[model samples]
Target: MSTATVNPAGGTSPAPAADACCTPSQGEAILNAGQAEALALRFKALGDPNRLRILSIVSASESAETCVCDLPEPLGLKQPTVSHHLKILVEAGILHREKRGVWAYYSVVPGALESLGASLAAKP
Candidate 1:
């Protein structure tokens, strides 16, 4: 019988089977083409350090919303540059934009981050 070997490091480890290593079972894809494309865009939007900082600021707001006007000061970026990053995030569906009079407020989309985490989970 085939069996796993113990490493003596206090954790159970499964045996590595060469035959099973590269074999793919007949199963549905982890992500469909469209879902992959959408997830890719969201990840791409997050690829930039500036965009990640912008998301962090909006996420930490007291009211769960922050005005675009308030972003530039903390980031030390100009309004136009901040707006450009916000636009990518909004297009990626990671944030919600609400225009209030002259300023635009941004908030994290409900369960957006959780959904993204779930998508990349190790187990379905």
Candidate 2:
């Protein structure tokens, strides 16, 4: 009752059993749809070069926060454009926005980067 096939070389080999060939690998847990969508939004926010630069500038500021006013000159971008990038970062939960007087200050959200990295880490 062997399930074997003849090869072109005139050799008879046992074909792979259906169950063995179709078995799924036991891998680590994967992200759910909601988690995937949220992480995708965060990654999408960081995908732009200008947005990444804005994050670096804000995170590297001496006061641990940066005013939107100061970002335009350093990035060589217009004020409105800088503000737009900041808005996306904030919406992605990667940055925090605070209003002081008429100015908006931006800072990296605590542990946000670490959380994003951990989501992609392999479980042991």
Candidate 3:
């Protein structure tokens, strides 16, 4: 993949291509290195089946949030395993975690998933 920097003053400029042979005239990437890295991390976190299911469960909650203790049964995983998945999702900014007494409740971050989807869409 080729990388480029967006000129803050106005526009974009190509930096260097990781592989010139595969590089196209597409010009610059809409995302910078840091942005690409962060996005990649989010995608990586979602690459797991368990993480996808965990996200689905939390998002499907009618109250828009679910307690950590509530995840195990539907997920068919132990509480500790579910918690581990939750931790990764939280770190990826895909979910928000709140502690109330001993239970941790999680909710999807407002526009995080939407933003990720938009990022993947072709831009005109």
Candidate 4:
């Protein structure tokens, strides 16, 4: 598995430092078009207010994880809609999902949630 590390936020993310010769070794290169697009897509998914709220809630959850059934009451959305958003988050790599019998669980993917912060710090 590719390890994604949750970095503490610095004043400026690495994206702004694309040409930075002083780039930290922790920063990974977006060496190809595929990587750039993938990172952009992840950011786009998080661009939504609802998804952002969901991420915040899930991130702050006691277990750092939650199930679909547990989300609606706090989010004030129907389960189906919540599930749809969850799917988008999962696809975008911001959230991790797993099946436990009939229900599905979601959790933030460590560094995955913070990729945008890194991208923003880059030169691009």
Error at 76, model 1, angstroms: 2.0
The per-model lDDT (C-alpha) reads 0.81, 0.80, 0.81, 0.76
After superposition of all CA atoms, the RMSD between model 1 and the true structure is 8.7
lDDT of 3 by residue, 1-124 (tens): 4444333564344654554344344846567888779778999999999899988888898475799888899788998899898889989998998998988889999999988899789441
TM-score of candidate 3 relative to the true fold:
0.71
The TM-score obtained by model 4 is 0.66
- Model 4 ranges with Cα > 4 A deviation: 1-36, 62-64
Which stretch of 10 consecutive residues in model 2 shows the poorest summed lDDT?
A: 19-28
**Top TM-score: which candidate number?**
2
lDDT of 4 by residue, 22-107 (tens): 54565455467887787778878888888888888888884756888888998889988998899899898888998889878788
- lDDT string for model 1 (1-124, tens) is 3643434575444554554444333456667788778778988998999899998888888376899888899899999999899999989899999998987889999888888888779543
Rank the models by TM-score, top first. Answer: 2, 1, 3, 4
Choose the strongest candidate by lDDT. 1
Q: Positional deviation of 3 in candidate 3, in angstroms? A: 25
TM-score of each: 0.71, 0.72, 0.71, 0.66
